[model samples]
Target: MSETRPAPLAGLKVIEISAFVAAPLGAMTLAQLGADVIRIDPIGGNIDANRWPISDDGTSIYWASLNKGKRSVTLDLKSEEGQKIATDLIAEAGTLVTNLPARGWLSYENLSQHREDLVMLRLNGSHDGKPAVDYTINAASGFPIITGDDERPVNNAIPAWDVAAGLYISNGIIAAELERRSSGKGQEITLALSDVMLATVGNLGYIAEVQATGKTRGPLGNGLYGAYGQSFATSDGREIMVAVISNKHWRGLGKA
Candidate 1:
């Protein structure tokens, strides 16, 4: 018989008060890694409960997909009793993940007061205090302009910024946990959707070209930017994305 090994975060607990993508996704990732994630939704449910990709019975498949493996609790956040319950949960868990606007009861100052070693990860729309979502951030980040084709600009069907920001938030939480082990204190981590998009585009050098040379990159259809790679249709009309960034890859493609 084989013995079972314990998960890395077997004893860890996470209290998540989040909606939509960033924070929820981050909490889900933590849950997957064996943390006991308790997702707190309002009495009517969070905004994502009825989001798109619903089932035939009107169930939100999208919500179910992201929230799997986590325990859920519904509360009336507006009520004083509900607020107290939430505070008690946070104090007990000592770790919180949320993307809602920082205010009132859920604020880090308020929660950390009760538990000095509380770790809070907060996600925001924009760094400049302006509200922004994944779509708006993608539009302003210069990705749409260089995405589709020369005829028109098209936004990505996938919420790339949301996913990236969520992963970043998960990474931040892990880092904070590591720090807390040594420092014997918790830290507040903040992330903005717009900042994540901007940083990603800048890292990819798309923003650097426009800033350094005033040369804006245009749409290149399915081809990779600054690389010899593109999608090609086969004889049977099946499309395949091919990357020939090096001479070896070019030769390999020719041979195939």
Candidate 2:
């Protein structure tokens, strides 16, 4: 007989007061890893509750997919009683994840008062603290301008910024958890959506390319950037992306 082992985040409890992609997705990832995640929604639901990818019967597949493995609760957060309840939950859990423009009762100042060693993470639209979303952030990040071979900028169908922000949120949460374990104290962690885009574009050399040469890489449809790679329709009518970035790969391609 085989023995069962508990999950890595087995005893970790997370109180999530978030909506949309980054916050919910991060909390959902922790829940999947066996954390006790309690997602608090409004009396009806959050903004993305009825987002796209609906089933034939009109079920919110998008919501289900993002919020999977987490427990849900609907509370009238505007009410004083609801705020008190939520404060108690955060004090008990000692951890929170959120991306909303949270202030007042939901602010770190207020929540930390309840539990001094509370770890709270918040996501903002930009470092300037202005309002923005994935598409808005991506537009100025220079990705859409070089995405496709078109006269007009081509926006990504995939919310790449949101996806990346979600991954960052998850990573930040784990780091904060480790810090709490080591210091016996908690701190606030924050990330701006625009900053995530800037970090990625800068790391990929796109920002440097424009500054160094005063020229930007134009769109090369279906081709790998700065690499010998392209997608072709195979004999089976299925499309395959081929790359020959190295001499060895080129030789291997020729041999085949």
| Residue runs of model 1 more than 4 Å from their true location after superposition | none
Q: Compose the digit string of candidate 1's lDDT tens values, residues 131-244.
A: 788999989987788787685778889999999999998899889998998998998888999999989988988777888998987888888876787888899989999887
Show model 2 residue runs off by greater than 4 Å: 234-238
**List of clashing residue pairs for candidate 2:** none
Query: Candidate 2 deviates by what RMSD?
Result: 1.6
Highest TM-score scorer: 1
lDDT of 2 by residue, 1-256 (tens): 8888898889989999988888888898888888999999998898888888899998789999999999888888899999999889989999999987769999999999999989998999999889789999989887787777776788899888889988898888888999889998999988899999999989988888888999986787778876798888989889988998999999999998
Pairs with steric clashes in candidate 1 = none
